[model samples]
Target: MSLFKNVLYFQAGFGFLANTILLFFYTFIMLGHRPKPTDLISCQLTFIHIMMFLTGGDICLTDIFETLNLENDFKCKTIFYISRVMRGLSICTTCLLGVVQAVTISPSTSLLAKFKHRLKVYMTYAFFCIWSFNLFYSSNQIFYVGGFTNVSETNQMKVTKSCSLFPKNYIIKGLILTVSVSRDVFLVGVMLTTSMYMVIILFRHQRQCKHLHSTSHLRASPEKRATQTILLLVVCFVAIYWVDFIISSSSVLLWMYDPVVLTVQKFVMYAYPTITPLIQISSDNRIIIMLENMHSKCHKILLNMFLPFL
Candidate 1:
């Protein structure tokens, strides 16, 4: 209806579409071709984004849970918990992606190179651990979030049109906040570290290329392009994540959720997931080539279908 609402709808629709395409691309790669080391993580992240759109009502244009006709409290708990888990997974997978890329680009003599043979094994283990941890960590949402009641303003913070968070004692809130902050900070730190490492590696490689040849000879390799994509994603994720962290933390601590602030926070929070697939799609030459092939095939089919009449 409103401009803001239209933007929200467009954002959700575009993001959902992009993520689905990316997911299918990775799925096809894994099934028919040799998968890259980072393919699994990319696939998982795309899945997470899709779930985020489905369960996170603020980001999704529709209230998907409403169609289920579940009890209000159950619906609230289910949505919040699943959304929290997906949010956690997004960061975890992004961090893993960067770290994997860093390892991928590391020089053969470097220490990280030693793990190259076993990187896939380690990534499988990492996925299991990340999912398990996020599932357990976000369980608190089940207890804290529920349908709004006639509770006093001081005792409840409205989270959505239908859901609100029950007030907890300062100690409980403090503990939850501490753990959340710790996890985010640690993951963000890892992203930054890996990003810096990749930058150094790229710089050195570029320097070496320049020394050996003219400037025009310095084309970005597959590894370099992948690294750059990951770095850009990390920067985008971190910037948006902190903006959301600040907004959410302030709302929780102050026991207030301003309508405008919440709206802005939703936009900020979904921005990363929305843009991630676009970044991947644009940077990935394989996907581009595949798309081009598909387009040409369709064009040939159309010409064949119409040429007899002409």
Candidate 2:
């Protein structure tokens, strides 16, 4: 295989591995523990990551098969649909996560604090509604998408995944497109608001902490670390998503049938889910404690072996 193809496999495989580890850590490692609301949401998010990578693998295979001429771009509707559904789930789960965390660190007197009583219950409902809606929204794929025939410059027959909407009603197509775009916009708006709210909360908490102590004495609490992590997650998600959105939109608008755009789209889409576990693990004290214990054991063993005379 070529270097670029190897790199593609490596990135996708690593992402798949990271997401798998997250699932294992949650399901097996935390099985004995009572699951927190955030933990449950995170488990759902991990599943989204797994699905995202699964589709990513599909994309990789499709790309390889196309390069080998075993398949063509017109044969990609399944992967495309899976990608769309998973992306939708990922975004909604992220927004839900932000809202959960925002409520988590809210001041006792704040409006969000009032929801604390039934927050988890509400979150569960929202998560279900989200995936349900997305599944329905993307179901149009099965109706409007199919293999499209195209001939190469060399007069070779090729078929790839494409919209077979020409025979369908234009009004229906427009309506579906509008609905899809509007739903995405609404989700993004909510994601934006939740992120900003979290930011404001962080700022206020920081000011209060500073008022109570010197800046040098300010230490990041677990809540603070978690808030920061969520902020990073939101920022990364929004940025990557918007960039992907713009690229995808531009491709459709300009009819840019370029391989480079597709490569970039896949990279951005996959990179976030791939690194999610590492980001969460960085803020998790349990992982840190585990690493520290491992380090101490290795040091002790090496010391015993090298300093036996002592």
Candidate 3:
């Protein structure tokens, strides 16, 4: 295999293995513990993580197969479609998560306050809407093959393949770009504005508490802690994602498809999900305790259930 192909395999395989471990630990061990109903935010995060795992796995397998000079077939097409959709969904879900966090942290008197209580209630419906939107938006991708190709009369290599909607269908491309750009912009804006607001609020609250000699208020402010942690996460996410977006967008605009860009894009998409566990671990102590408790309970239950058979 060529060096580029070898790199692709290495990256994809590493991503796949990492995501698999994450999925197992988070979904089975962490998420399954205690069997309590999940909140909106938790459920959304879980869904995104699962999708990320699957997409990573697909990318790894597809790249491996392509490196082996395998021919594209029906299964390849299916994988292509699913991978594209999952990637798009991952972006959408991450943005949704940021939005949810922003809403959660918004002041009670804010316009979003009315929707606060309904977030949990409407979370399922909101996910359904997002899923539906992505399903249709990516439906045209079902006809694609995913692999490297050399552009005519150029040394530039691109990942090009068939799709239901070709470039001739500018309307569809326009709609897709519009939806994608609008969603990304909104999420980025919310993340930045909310984070800034939270910082200012924290500063003001600290100043007022110090003035009043109320150290307890400063220490016990859930809003301040949640806001700060989420702000950090959003910052990390945006930092990685903005670079990926710029590179990918540039590739598309300049029509200079290159293997390096493809590899980087894969890394960024997979990294988001793989590192989420660390974020959760740092942000939410309660969740860690809950997961541990659930694990213990499950172990006891499993021992009791299997002891007789043993």
Regions more than 4 Å wrong, model 2: 1-4, 57-78, 151-170, 211-220, 290-310
Please state the error at residue 93 of candidate 1 in Å: 0.6
> Across residues 264-288, which tens digit of lDDT does each residue of candidate 3 receive?
6766766666566566556665656
lDDT of 1 by residue, 167-285 (tens): 88889988998899999999999999999999999889888886675544445577688889999999999999999999999998888997777777877877998999999999999
The order by descending TM-score is 1, 2, 3
CA lDDT of 126 in candidate 3? 69
- What is the clash count for each candidate, in the order shown? 0, 6, 0
Give per-model TM-scores: 0.94, 0.78, 0.68
Strongest candidate by TM-score: 1
lDDT of 3: 0.61
Report every candidate's CA lDDT.
0.88, 0.72, 0.61
So what's the TM-score on candidate 1?
0.94
